[model samples]
Target: MSFRESVATATVSRSVHFFPLHLRRDLVRQAAEDLDRYHGKAAADYWRSTCRGLAADLTAKGCSDDEMREQIMDFQAAVQVALLEMHREQLAQG
Candidate 1:
């Protein structure tokens, strides 16, 4: 599968609450980093596109802009935490 596809799959799978919190977070962070490495600016563009789609969909479903922004912020925060954890894991492993 493509990088985007893999990331989407990992995101969806983790969202179902099947994985442990740490593992899910690690997977997300790794997926994001791997995508960024492989696709560069395109990866960031994809993230923006996804966030925009998310906002638009939420708005269409009657969510307010503030709510949408908050949701996105929460997602970003989670990603940041996961990324940090991944970095730490790499350092420890090294």
Candidate 2:
């Protein structure tokens, strides 16, 4: 299903929520660092901790858990798409 279609079908996904501009700018940097640091062979616990940290950060920033879940889900989708594109580019270059 298209991103729009899926989001439209889900009640909580009705809108794209962005962080405050400066915080938004930091998000990609944070995600990259967290993913790079936490992702690896046998790194399940590491990744889980990273996700927990992210949720904590959201909570500290005053996002409700439901709101955090919705936004994080959307963020994950975007990150997956970005990773796919990077992989495709690497394969093409190779």
Candidate 3:
């Protein structure tokens, strides 16, 4: 069963195994832009909601932790790619 890699990956390293953090630069950038007009939890809330929605989508599509373990570059891999993109962008600017 091939799981669709809809969202990009972000590697939030806490172990040798990569976490599936579905964070895309465009999505995060849009979230930042949308949240820029707000402050505090309002901004945080947007990100929280976005992540939740993405998680839900994965679940709805039957993307379980077990399935993640099976795929080569599945949603789990996407998580790392997403974060790496963000970190790269930050580095480029600095």
**How far does residue 20 in candidate 1 sit from its true spot (Å)?**
18
Q: In candidate 2, how many Å is residue 10 off?
A: 31
Model 3 TM-score, all chains together: 0.39
Model 3 C-alpha lDDT per residue in residues 35-94, reported as the tens digit of each score? 545679886786567656766665566666554444323433454455566668879999
In angstroms, the error of model 1 at 70 is: 1.2
Structure candidate 2, residue pairs in collision: none
Please report how far candidate 1 places residue 61 from its true position, in Å: 1.9
Give the per-residue lDDT digits (tens) of candidate 2, residues 12-71. Answer: 655555473224535644554456455565356754665677778877876877988776
TM-score of each: 0.55, 0.56, 0.39
Q: Write the per-residue lDDT of candidate 1 for residues 1-94, one digit (tens) a residue.
A: 9999999999866622122223445545654575445466887887777667756866776566676677666666666676677678889999
Task: Report the candidate with higher lDDT, 1 versus 2.
Answer: 1
- lDDT (0-100) at residue 44 of candidate 1? 82
Name the TM-score of candidate 2: 0.56
Q: What is the lDDT of candidate 2?
A: 0.62
